[model samples]
Target: MLLTRTNPVIKPRTLTSIHEQLRDHGVNLFHTQMHEREAFKAMFSFGGTLETLDRAQVNNIDKAILNARDFASEVVDILKAAQNAEGEGAHLAATSAPMTSSKVA
Candidate 1:
C-alpha cells in the first residue's frame, strides 16, 4: 500500500501564517499539538527506526500522517475558495463599471 505523504515544500513561516488565517476565519484546523511530538521524532530519526518502534509509537506516527493529510486538504480548499472569490470580485467590478468611448470628429 502506498501511503500519501504531505508535501514538505511549505516553509514553517508559511504554515504558521496559514494556521493563523484559518483561525481568524473561524475555521479550526491543523492542531499540531496532537501530533507534534511524533512528527518531531519522525523528522530526526533514521530511515530504519520505524522497525524498532513500539505499537504506540507507530500509532502516533499514523495519527500524525492522518492529521497532516487533513491539514493539507483543508489548506487546498481554503486557497481554492479564496481564488474563486477574487475572480468573482474582479468580474463584478468589471461589469459594474460604466463604459466610455472617446471620439474625435
Candidate 2:
C-alpha cells in the first residue's frame, strides 16, 4: 500500500522521491540492492511454462509468497518513513526557499 498508483503519476513521483531521499541520506547501497534483488526475483521466480507444477511445488511457491509478505511489510515500513520524511522536507523547503533566496540576493 505504500504505492498508491490510482493516479499514474504517483508511482514515478514516489520513486523519484525515494531516490532523492536516498541520495540526500548518502545511501546508494539500499537502492541498488533493492533493484538488483527485484530483478533477480523476477528472473528466477516466474514460471512461464504451461505444464502444471506438482502439489509440493505449488505448496512451496505458496509458502515462498507467504514468507515474502513479511518482507513486503518491512519494505512498506521503510517506504512510509521515507515518504513521511520527504513530505516534511518539502514543506520545510517551500517555507525556507523564499527567505533564503532573498538573503542570498
Candidate 3:
C-alpha cells in the first residue's frame, strides 16, 4: 500500500485512510514521531530499522506524515477562524456561539 502526502487539502475519507495506515502507529504524529510514542511506537510491527520497510511504503508514510502535518495546518486555520468569529469588540473574549451561520454576510 502506498500513501502520498503531496496534496495539502483533504477529504474526511483521506483522514480515515491515513488512520488505516497507522496500523499500530496510532492516529497521527502525536503518537508516531519517536520510538515510544504512547499510541504508535509500541504497536509498530516492523522489526528493524526504517530501512527494512519497502522504499515505497516508507515514502508513502512520509507522504502520510505530510498529510497529517497539513491536517494540523488546517486545524490551526479552523481554530483561528472560529476564534475570530467569536470575537466582537476589543474587550470581549471569544465566546462559543449558540449557533453559527453558514454564510457570513
The candidate scoring highest on lDDT is 1
Candidate 1 C-alpha lDDT tens digits along 1-105: 112233444447765686677788887554433334455365556344433556554456556556657666767887899999999999999999999988887
The local distance difference test score of model 2 is: 0.49
Better by lDDT, candidate 3 or 2: 2
> How does candidate 2 fare on TM-score?
0.39
| Local distance difference test values of all predictions, in order | 0.59, 0.49, 0.47
Cα displacement (angstroms), candidate 2, residue 81, comes to: 1.2
Q: Who is ahead in lDDT, 1 or 2?
A: 1
**Of the candidates shown, which would achieve the greatest TM-score relative to the real structure?**
1
Indicate the TM-score of model 1: 0.52
Q: 50-76, model 3: which lDDT tens digit per residue? A: 334555434444544454465567667
Clash count per candidate: 0, 0, 2
TM-score of each: 0.52, 0.39, 0.33
Reference-based lDDT, residue 66, model 1: 61
Error of 1 at 80 (Å): 0.6
Q: Could you tell me the C-alpha RMSD of candidate 2 in Å?
A: 14.5
By summed lDDT, the worst window of 10 consecutive residues in model 2 runs over 31-40
Off by over 4 Å in 2: 1-53, 58-62, 99-105
Report the error of model 1 at residue 63, Å.
Answer: 1.4
